[model samples]
Structures are given as C-alpha cells and as structure tokens.
Target: MFYFDATYVLLIPAILLSFWAQAKISSAFNNYSEVRSINGYTGADAARKLLDANGLYDVPIEVIPGKLTDHYDPANRVLRLSEEVYYGSSVASIGVAAHETGHAFQHKQHYVPLEIRNSIVPAVNLSSNASWILFFIGMIFSIPFLARIGVVLFAAVVVFHLITLPVEFNASSRALKLLESRGILYGDEVKGARKVLSAAALTYVAAALMAISQLIRLIIISRDRD
Candidate 1:
C-alpha cells in the first residue's frame, strides 16, 4: 500500500510492457504450434523424442491436469506436462516440451547452475510462504523482532529468484539450439519458438524484479519503524 514513486512508476510500465509483449508472443506461438508440428507429434511425443534423442529415454513424461503447468522434476526425472501441453499438437506445445527436455539434458550433463538452483528449492519454498505471514504478524503486534525474522525469510526468496534466472535461461537456450540444430522446427517456426521461450523467460525476470521491489519496500517500511 505504499505510494508509487518515480522508480516504481517506471518499473510498472516496463513490467506491463513486458507482459503485453509476452502475451502476444505466447498467443503467436500457441497458434503456430497448433498449426504446425515438426513430425506431427504431440507434446508428449515430442518430449519423448527429444529425451530419446539425447539418450534420456529413462526420463518419464506424464500428463498432469491443467494448462501451461508443464515442468521437469530432476529429482524424480519426471517430465510433467499439463493436459493441454501434453496432448496438444501445437508449436507452443512442441516448444514447451522441448524446453523441458532441455532441463533433462542439463541434468544428464550435471549442469552446475541447475544443480545450485535445485539445491535451494526447499529453502525458497519455505521462505516465500512464511515471510509475508511473519511480516504481517510482526506489524500487527508491533514487534520489531518478528519483522526482522520476516526480513531474513524474504532474503531467501530474493536469493532463490536470482538463482532461478540462469537455470531458466540455460534451459531456454538449450531448447532453442536443439530445436534449430535438430530441425525440430523450421524457419518461421524457429523464430516463433524463440519468441515463446524468450517471453517465458521474461516471466521469471519479472518475478525476480518483483521480489527485489518487494524487498526494497519491506526495507523501507522497516526504516519507518518508530
């Protein structure tokens, strides 16, 4: 509930523009994906092909319920695709599936950045949920110590966001290079896939920026404490 300053106002437009750009990119990729398939394969099929091609056939691909809920869990070596992403035969699906497969490939190679990011997951998960709760309680009770605890907890979230960036970027980079080199996507399709992955990457960037902004806000609030 803080007033918007010049810096925040500038950031608001930047974030909004990025979101708008991403929406356009996503819509374009979704349409292109639905219209074209490298081998006329579904998302599941594409993912399997990529995994097998990389000698990662042991990686399992499963369909979960939802839209755009696809993710790869290195721990279980499972590539979870949402119903739409798993079954749909679209350029978007192919791109997404390939992107996730990239993560699997990274794991196979023991990618260091991913290893670091994965290592912090539990701590990040715990902190993101706990921080605001602690901050609220501390504020309500007029206790500086609880607010300080919230500050510490939020630090974990900021760190997590920073760590996530490289992991995501590398995954997308791997996907793009693989798609192009393997002819998984042709000319326009390659461009579209790049757009899709790039836009998707921005969401993470936005999340990190938001986390940083919130951390700054919290610090400002702490400074105002009597």
Candidate 2:
C-alpha cells in the first residue's frame, strides 16, 4: 500500500539526481578517456607504481573486462581494473586507477573510516534487503512497529552511504595528489584527472541522497500508520 502512495513522489528529486550523476560520470570519463597522459602510464602501470612506492608491492593489479567497473578488493588486497582503465593511458583511466589504489593506501594505513565501513558492510548488506521486506510486510499488515523497524534498518544503509562519501572523497583526493606528485599527470592534465574523480564522487553523493530519501519516506509512512 505504501509503495505507490503519494510518498512515492518524494523519490523524484533523488531519482533525477541519480540520473544526472550517472550522466556526469559517463560524459566526464568518456571525454577524458580520450586524452592520454603525458607520461603515458596506463591505469595499471600508474596503480602499480603508486602501490610499489608505498611499499605495497605485494598488492596485485588485475584487468577485468567492463566499463568503469574498477574496484579495490580489500580482503584479497588486490586491485581490479576495467579493460579500459587497465590498459588505457588516458587521464580518466589513470585517475580511476589511482582512486582504487588510494583504497589500498587506506587499507595499509588502517584508515579509521575505511575500517569502520568494512566492519559494518555485512550488516548493511543484510539490512538493505531485509529493510524492504520488513517494511513491505508491515505496511501490508498495518504493523506500524514492523515498518518502523524497517525504517531503522534502512537507516544503517544511509549511514553506510554517508561514511562512504568521506572515504570516496578522501581516496580521490589521494589519487589526485599522488598523480600530480608522481608526475603521471601535471598542469592541465591533473585538472582533467580531478574532473574525472570529482564526477565519480558525485555518484556516491547521489547514492547517499537516494538512501536518505528512502529512509525519510519510510519514516513518514510508518508514522502515519502509527
């Protein structure tokens, strides 16, 4: 009953922002991906250099096929990059690669936010799914308490997204700095790299906003039932 209620309109802004974020990242990445770095280091090469410079020689970088699906696997301590990023020496590729490697830096240094984020990941995973189930069942049965519980659970998802902002931003900051310092990108090239990372960061911001919007909608619906 709550799913398609007037409350559904609350999501419009977030939905629009999410679309804008996706488009921003795509445009920025595609534009910069065409501009090769002066030093000519592919994403993988830049990542390896950064990792090795930080004494993270053991961490491995692997290429995976995809478009901007790159990520750092903290558990396995491996960095996986998309085909474009792993091989392309473009500004966007190097920027994305450096951002993933930045996560490695955080891991090696035991960055507090990163650790905290990792610790709650399991709960967030469960909550993300269970929150909807509980909310739907509660709304269908008019169990305000159950729906409220769902709201609480979803709050964790929101928290995860919030913490993710700083983590992602910090990693991007690190990547930009490292890229400049390492001479992988300089002057206008560094500016382009920053643009790529900044665009990517907005996607995280959009996710956090969407999560918060859902939580607020759930709270309103549950409170009405109460």
Candidate maximizing TM-score: 2
lDDT of 1 by residue, 1-226 (tens): 3333334544574477568766866676667656666567787887887888899978889999876789999889999998877887777888888899988998999899789888988988898889988887876678878877898899889988888889889988988888778777777777877778887888888878878777876766755663
Distance from true location, Cα of 84 in model 1, Å: 2.6
Model 2 lDDT at residue 154: 96
TM-scores for all predictions: 0.88, 0.98
Assess the local accuracy of residue 102 in candidate 1 as a C-alpha lDDT between 0 and 100: 86
Report how far off residue 92 is in candidate 1 (Å): 1.5
The alpha-carbon lDDT assigned to residue 21 of candidate 1 equals 60
lDDT of every predicted structure (CA atoms): 0.80, 0.93
Worst 10 residues of 2 by lDDT: 1-10
Residue 54 in model 1: lDDT: 91
